[model samples]
Target: MNKILSILAVGMVGACSAVSAADIIGTVTYKGAAPAEKTITPILDDPTCGASYNGKAPTTHFYAVGANGEFGDVIVSLKDTTGSTGASAAPAVMDQKACLYTPTILTVQTGQKLIVKNSDPVLHNVHLNPTVAENEKANEASINAAQMPNGADLNYSFVKPEKFLKFQCDVHPWMFAWVTIVDSPYYSQTGADGKFVIKNVPPGKYTIVANHRKAGEKTQDIEVKDASVTINFTFEPK
Candidate 1:
């Protein structure tokens, strides 16, 4: 009789433990509105512009996912999800191709090396410029490294957290890309559907930072304790 009681007690504890092990997850969608399209002023505006805002005109955002302007990249929610297996994350890849970064959205851990790959037929000098706006040589680091060609990777690391680094090919000035280096492992780049997830987080409270670049960032307070929780975000372009 005592043996039977002990067995049942163990079974109940095992069931409770199993239930507590599930991770939190959910999708982030725009709340009431979508981001507004961002525009820029040209140096010398043509009379064709027919607008009055200084030399500023709506920029011709080339890529379907304009990495240069508002609604540019996805804002990943970091703290909204939590569990045990989230710490000690691995570094992600950020490649340069056709004169631009392959993934418009990039997530990286502090001290993580950024692997800059080049696949241009011509020689390209990878220069890292620090800034929030575009300018000529904004404290750029002209790598003395070999002029990469074909498909070679150049490994670089930032000593400090920069605002945002602009990568350019000195040989091909038109080929420009950007990457935002953050200090945590929870960063994520949202997809076209505007959804993201961070799994296996330990029980705790966190501030989920949603960076949309031109539209800025949206932060939310989240607490992860018992089971998985749900959280979302949205930004209207300004």
Candidate 2:
């Protein structure tokens, strides 16, 4: 009788663990001809920021395509459903340097703290204007006034999920960035190598989405059960 009870206890434990979340790993690639890079000459230049660029116009890294057609700065997220992971405790960081926003694009979980830092020696005001529906009200979000050059860091949290939030500098017209706020913690931005991973997703069926500033959006249906799943996406000219 003792041996039978021990076996039942172990079986229950295994079943419980099997229903837990797992990781989804994938790479984003682009075939065919890559998009040409564009350079922007700072129109509203302050002597402080202009000095860093050394008089040469800065180019946009919007479409960072690699030799193997790897695409970078793409946002990847799992479709919101009944079952999803919780928000992460760690905060996401965005820095402004050399008269441009570093990382260019970023993704964070809704209600998670986002730290925006200005590493430059000039003043910059970070403004967030979210794209929302006509009927819905927008989140009037802005940083603590103009971030005085070499001033303290700015922090904020968005209660609602906004796919793409526009980040711009009130002082500098050319300075801009994009931020994606997701309800679930299963979201990531493709790195320079165009690779991303969403961990701790519950075992179930989900629609995985990939969005790029220029290439637009793509979706794929996937079923995650027990073990890790590998999926790849290709974004090309329409």
Query: Which number leads on lDDT?
Result: 2
- Which segments of model 1 are wrong by more than 4 Å? 1-24, 30-72, 77-91, 131-146
Error of 2 at 42 (Å): 2.2
TM-score of 2: 0.84
lDDT of 1 by residue, 1-238 (tens): 5999999988886777554633445554444344343454341243322233355443423222423222335546464332212234454566654344566456554456667766554466777665533222322343434465565677655444443466666654444566665555455666655556665555577887777555566888887775667776756435
Q: How many clashes does each candidate structure show, in the order listed?
A: 8, 0
The window of 10 residues in a row where model 1 has the poorest summed lDDT is 61-70
